[model samples]
Structure formats: C-alpha cells, structure tokens
Target: MISTQLLFGQLLLGLINGSFYALMSLGLAVIFGMINVVNFAHGAQYMLGAFAAWLLLHYAGIGFWPALILVPALVGLIGMAIERTMLKRLYKVDHLYGLLLTFGLALIIEGGFTHVYGSSGQQYPVPAALAGGWNLGFMFLPIYRAFVVAASLMLCLGTWLVIEKTRLGAYLRAATENPALVQAFGVNVPVLMMLTYGGGVALAGLAGVLAAPIYQVNPLMGSNLVIIVFAVVVIGGLGSIMGAIVSGYVLGLCEGFAKVFYPEASNIVVFVIMAIVLLVRPSGLFGKGD
Candidate 1:
C-alpha cells in the first residue's frame, strides 16, 4: 500500500503542475474562442514572462511581487502589438495560415532567446515570505506550492466569472458569434479582438511568472510544456473555458498517481489519457461538438 505521505505529496506536486496547465490551457481556450486562432506562440510568450521577471530583477532591482504584476502587463502589451500588426492580417485567410504564422513566431522567439541566453536554464528564487513548508502530519506542504495552487484557482475562477457573467464578457461572446452584428451594434469588434488576444497572452505570461521560481527560467521551458498544455486543451475541448480548467487538474492528478505506481509511464500518462478521451469523445470532456 502506498503510504499516505507519498500519496499526498505526489498529489500536491500534481496540483502545482496542474495549476500551470490550467492557466496556459485557459488562455488557449480564450484565444481560440474569440479569434479562432491557434496561438502556437503562446509558449514563447510564457518564456518571455519568465525572462521579463529575470531582467527586472537583474537590471532594475525589482522583486518577485512587482514582477508578478508588471511582467504580464508588458507581455500583454507586446501581445496587443503582435495581434494588431501580424495576426490581424491573417484573419481573413485560412486558419492554417494563422497556425503557421504563430508557429513561425514561436520558432523566431525561441531562437532569438537561445542566441542571447544560450540554452541554459536560469534560477529564480522563491519569495522570502513563502519559503517555508507546513507539516500536515500526513505530508509536508511547501508554502510556495500551496500559494501557486490557491492563486491559480482564484485566477481561473475570476476569469470564468468575467467571461460568463460580466457585460464585457457578454459583448465578447456576442462578438464571437457575430462580429459583424456586434460591430453594427456600435461595438468595436476589432478592438475587442485585440483585447481578447492580449488577455489570453497575459494569462500565459502570468503562468510563466508563477513558474519561474519552481522551474528553471529557460527559453525551452515553455516549449517543453506547451505541448502538454495543448494536449490538455484538446482533452478538455478547444474553446472551452471550464473544460480547460477541469481537465488540467484531472490529468495532472492522473499523472501524479502514475508517477507513484509506475514511474516510467508518468511522462506518457497525459498523452495516453488524451488518446483515450479522443477515442471516447473527440470533442473533449467539456467541449461542445459542432
């Protein structure tokens, strides 16, 4: 029998990993819902977020707390610029074009960072305030990991509420359904698109910032993780906000269990689940099929 400590500890680790999966996949879902674009560059933007935090620390003497707020904003602004300048041009074309464009952009960003930073991983220290752990009798829980889980849950829930309940969310939904009609109703559909894309990119950046302390701040960090996030999105359903959130955590826990029982299979467990889900429900667990 697995000890309670081992079980709980792995589950905690899974939850931490799931937090990032949920955030990144949520951003993917939002962008796809609003723009019908697969943002392959999302991972690179996540890398940028970590690097942004690193730069602020080394150059400007900024700390983690401030970087948490500023990095996302800066990355969102960059996302807005990219959407306005490059991605907007591909809207009328085939969706494949957008995918290719973003994929190319990802390669460019990763390559550029590699040229500058090499392929090495940089370390980001945990905040002094959250450097400790709690002994819960069954297992010890790191405060930083707990913080990540709590913060991610709040962020995901807040995003869900904004998209599902708010007036701006109503407008976004209306625009998605009929941009022409929404524009006819005096809504600036173009600007809405820009904001939506920026918002999605910002979520990725936020995830990157949260991740910097746990993982090495490396250029390929996002590249390695993004594929799993995409799988999580697919398993949850594309364009599904809640689906992304749920599937991320579920699959993360599943992976964690696999790690305990069958360590060799842990890495492939998520993909295996993805394959099973596709076979059972191609549209995803929470996705609405067309």
Candidate 2:
C-alpha cells in the first residue's frame, strides 16, 4: 500500500517530468503538422540549447536568467538557418529522405559534441531565486521544479494560443491546410514555414534550459529524453498539439506510479502503453488518419 505522502511526491515529480515531455512533444507536433518533417534533429537542438546556456554562464559570465533568453534566441536563429539551407531542399522529396537527413544531422551533432566535450556530464546551478523548497505537510518540493512546471505550462498555453486564437494562428492553420491557396492570398508560406520550424526548435531549446539544473548537461541528455518524448507524442497523437500536452503529463504520472508499484517495469511501462494505444487506435487518440 502506497502512503498518501509518497503518492503526492511522485505526482509532483511526474508533473515536473511531464512539463518537459509536453513542451518538447508539443514542439515536435507543431513542426510536423506544418511541414510533415520528422525533425529527428530536435533532440540535438535541445542539447545545443543547454550547451549554449552552459557556455554563456561559464565563459561569458552571463547568468542563468540572461542565458535562458539568449540561448533560445540563438538556437532558434540556427534552426531557421538550417530550415532555409537544408530542409527547404527536401520539401519535395520523400519524407523518408527527410527523416534520413535529420537522423544524419543528429548523428553529426552528437558526434561533434562528443568529440569536443567528451561524454561526461556537466552541472548547472539553480538560480538563487529558485534555490529552495516549499515544505508541505508531508513533503518538500523544490522551488526550481515548481518554477519549471509553471513556466512550461505557461509556454505551452502560449503556443496553443498562438496557433488557435490570433491572426498569425489563422494564417498558420490556413497554410497547413493548403499552402498554395494561402500563398495565393498574398501570404508568404515559405517564410512562415521557416519561422514555425525555428520556433518549434526554440521551444525544445527552452526545455533543455529548464532541464539543465535538474539533469546533468550532456550530449546524450536530449537524445535519451527525445525517445521518451516521441513515445509520448505517439501515444498522444501525431500533429495534435493539445493531445501531445495532455498525453505527456498523463503518461508521466503513470510512469511515476509504476516506479513506486513495480519498479522493474518502470522503464518499459511507457513503451508498453504506447504499443497498446497503437493497437487500439493507430492514428492515436487525437490524430486524424492520414
């Protein structure tokens, strides 16, 4: 029998991990929804964000707060560059080719980082403002984790608003349905496409920054998490923003519970759930059949 205190603590941890999973998976869904690219390099891009933050703090004497803003901007700009120079060329090709290209890019990035940084992890300190915990009746919750949950949730809501409520959102939705038709209406679909991709990647970068304090900063960090995120996305639904967010958190909580009840199955629990979901609804809970 699980104690209420332990259950509550695990729920909090689950929500914390869910924030990252949801943020990353939502970004992936947005990118895939617009461009139909697999974006295999997303994990590498996320890792780059952490590395950027680490660099700014260590070499440039920049603080975490500044790096939090600057790193995502820098990484977003890099993503835009990649989309224009490399991704654009593959637009007319088979999606498999695009996936292959991104996979290769992921390899290149991981290899480059491994060459320079070696495989060992680096630490990032929690900012002074967030370096404490709130004591509840039965447990203490780290302030940074709470901050991460709040910030990530806000960003996710903001992204949803941008895609669903605003004029830009209208254009994006229209463009996704029929790029040629939207382009005929005097909108520059290509530019919007590039920006969307960059923004999605930038979100991943932001997740990395948020994660740096909790997890060791390393090349493998993003790659490892990305798989679980992919599973989350799959279980949620491809290209469904709301679904991605909901599924990420739900699955994260489930994983946390599994850890407490059947520790041995925790590792495979997510994948097992994904397989079951796939068997039941191949298009996923919120996905439209392609």
The residue-level lDDT of candidate 1 at 180 comes to 95
For candidate 2, the 10 contiguous residues with the lowest summed lDDT are 281-290
Angstrom error at residue 205, model 1? 0.4
The digit string of per-residue lDDT tens for model 1 on 46-155 reads 99999999989988989999999999999999999999999999988999999999999999999999999999999899999999999999899999999999999999
Tell me the lDDT of candidate 1: 0.94
lDDT agreement with native, every candidate = 0.94, 0.90
lDDT of 2 by residue, 1-290 (tens): 88878888888888888899999999999998888888999999899999889888899899889988898899899999999999989988898988888889989998999999999999999999999999997888999999999999899999988988999989988998899999999999999999999999999899889989999999988899889989988988898889888988888888889877888997888899999999999988889883
On TM-score, the leading prediction is 1
In order, how many clashes per candidate? 0, 0
TM for candidate 1 is 0.98
TM-scores for all predictions:
0.98, 0.97
Q: List where candidate 1 sits over 4 angstroms from the true fold.
A: none
